[model samples]
Target: MRIGLDIGGTKIDAVAVAPTGQTVDRVRVPTGFGAEQVVANTLQVIDALRGRTGTTPTAVGIGIPGLIDHETGWVRHAVNLGLSEVALGPLVAEHVGLPVQVENDVNVAALGAAQAMHLDGAHAYLNIGTGLAAGIVVDRRLWRGARGNAGEVGHIPVLADGPPCVCGQRGCLETVASGSALAAAWPGHPGTTATEVFDSADAGDPAATAVRDRFVAGVASAVRILVVTVDVDSVVIGGGLAALGERLLLPLRADFDEAARSSPFVASLGLSSRVLLAPLDQPLAALGAAHLAPESAVTTA
Candidate 1:
């Protein structure tokens, strides 16, 4: 058996997958702060999942939010998670009596999405959630930088002098294009989430329409950077904001179509449909963590 955990800002989900990669048991629990509680919750879920099956998993993997240092299993920093400098992998491994592999939540999802596409060799996966992040894959492997922090498409500067981002940067793609940005831009509106913004956009409200358009432009602007910087043939867009479907993608495609006319990098390459939805069900982070576990049967190259 293979155990996979998806650790998030507020919740932790764990699943036991059979050797064939089919989920056989699952458990969900609220995530606690600090190193001790996080591991406790994870153990709680793992024990429950294992209890249901009365079998020990061969290995465990986790897809975790925030910036994780893959080499040392240290969480360098993650504001939303209220954690920094916590060594996660060794702690979990020691506590659970199993080998543990950790991966960035976004990168895991990207890998899972790419695996679904069968587009090995090279690809880029962008996930637009509370914020924006991308996962770059090189020849079927995740390209983590020295600190395991790569594919951070959110921090790239987009607007010269725009609103301040939670990351302490101004005019970042995430501040303008992410679900949090949409929720912030229209606080007085009836709804409190990105889904509400889409309903308003679909209803043709002017303020909502303006907010939607600006966010889409930010997305397009970011994609332009990703496509040029990484030179990937396909870009997959997923996460909470992508639930808007064409509300986000159509405008982005139009923007890309117009911008590529003057761009050098994209002129020689074929961008596949500009934006494609990620196929990982129930979010990719935890599932991707499952993929990183030693027992995962990754499709062959």
Candidate 2:
């Protein structure tokens, strides 16, 4: 068995995967802030999973947000977790006595999403959560570019003069399309802003409709960018807002269809047909983390 952990801003989801790619056991624990606390919590989850499964895992894999040196398993600029620069992999491995590998959260999610969706060939997992970004997977393996920024599509400037982004840029696709963007456009319901925006738009609220339309347009633009850039086999939409399901998918597809009618190039790409929703039922990040473990370390029956 191999252990995989998805360390998020809120919690750490841990799982043990059998050699056959089945999850044998799973556990969740609150995530901690800062390097020390985060490391401690991660170890705690590993211990918890071991106790639950009553078996020693061969290797450990971690998926976390922020910039990471995949080769070194070093994490940097993880502001949300209060980690500036930490050798997360080496520390975890020293403590647990198991080989460990770390990767960007979105990359791991792309790996997991591909496995869950049974996608072969090139695909992109477009994460539309608090921000917008994508993870590219080609032939079931992550394609992290030379600098590990292959899928930072969110920072692409779409509007010449638009709202500023946290990345110190103006008119970024993220500023117009992400969960944060939806919350900023339709505030007051901190927890349910996306739902509120879509629901109100459905009721014909002009203001809400405008927000929804702009958000959908930004998303459609992202889809187009991914399809044209990598020409991936498909783009799977996932993240918190994806819970909106067809409410989000329908409009996004309509936008694509409408654009296709005007642009033959767009029609030939079949952007609408290539778009898909990630499976909501599985823990993609954790599963993908498991897959990150070296094949040699996976134990067979």
Candidate 3:
């Protein structure tokens, strides 16, 4: 068996995958802050999976949010996790005595989405979370690009003087299209801000409708950029807002359809038809991490 863990800021979603790609066991634990605590919780989750499965895993994979050196499993500037720089892969491997692979969270999610959706050719996994970004997958393999910035689409400035982004940019796609953007536009929601905005819009609130429409337009722009630049076979939307399901997807598609009406270029691309949502039922990040295990260690049925 191979173990995979999706270590998020709030929780760690872990799984044990058999060679045939079946999940043997899964576990979840609250993530700890700081490097030490994060590493400790990761080990604890691995132990829990092993105890439940009653078998030792040959290799382990971790999908985490950060700037990662995938070759060495080194993590840098994982602000949410309170990690500055750490040899996460080595530390975990030393304790568990297994070869470990660490990769960016979105990248792993892309891999999982490809496998789950049975997608072939090229595709992009667009994550619309607190920030916006994408993961590129071609023929089931990740394309990190030369500097590992292949899918950093969120930072691409759209409006010349819109809002200041955390990346020190003005009017980035993320500034207008992400969870943080929704929170800024529709604050004071105890629950999900995106849900609240959509609900208020559905009730015909002009302010809320404006916010929703702008956010949807920004998302549609992101999809257009991905398709036009990479020409991916499809763009799968995932992340916290995706929980809104068809409520979110229908508007995005509608935006594309509206644009298609004006521009033959947009119509030719079939932008509306090429967009999709990631499977809500699966822990895509953890599943994708499993695929990062050494090929020789993976067993197929």
TM-score of each: 0.84, 0.95, 0.95
What lDDT tens digits, residue by residue, belong to model 1 across residues 204-290?
898888888888887776676777787776788887677777666777787777666887555555443746767636545555566
Which residue pairs clash within candidate 2? none
lDDT (0 to 1) per candidate: 0.74, 0.90, 0.90
Question: What are the per-residue Cα lDDT tens digits for candidate 2 across 1-301?
Answer: 9888999999999889998888999999989899999999999999989888998988998999988888777898688999978988888888788888898899999999988899999999999999999999999888888888988999999889889998999999999999999999988878699999998999999999999999999999999999998999899999888898999899999999999999999899998889999989899999999888474221221
- Which clashing pairs does model 3 show? 19-299
Error of 1 at 123 (Å): 2.1
Off by over 4 Å in 2: 293-301
lDDT of 3 at 257: 93
Model 3 CA RMSD to the hidden true structure, in angstroms = 3.1
TM-score head-to-head 1 vs 2, winner: 2
Local accuracy of candidate 3 as per-residue lDDT tens digits, 1-301: 9888999999999999998889888999999999899989999999999889998888998999989888778898799999978888888888888888889999999989998899889999999999999999999888888989998999999998999999998999999999999999888864579988999999999999999999999999999999999999999999888888899899999999998899999999999889999999999999989877374221221
- Each prediction's RMSD over C-alphas, in Å, is 4.3, 3.0, 3.1
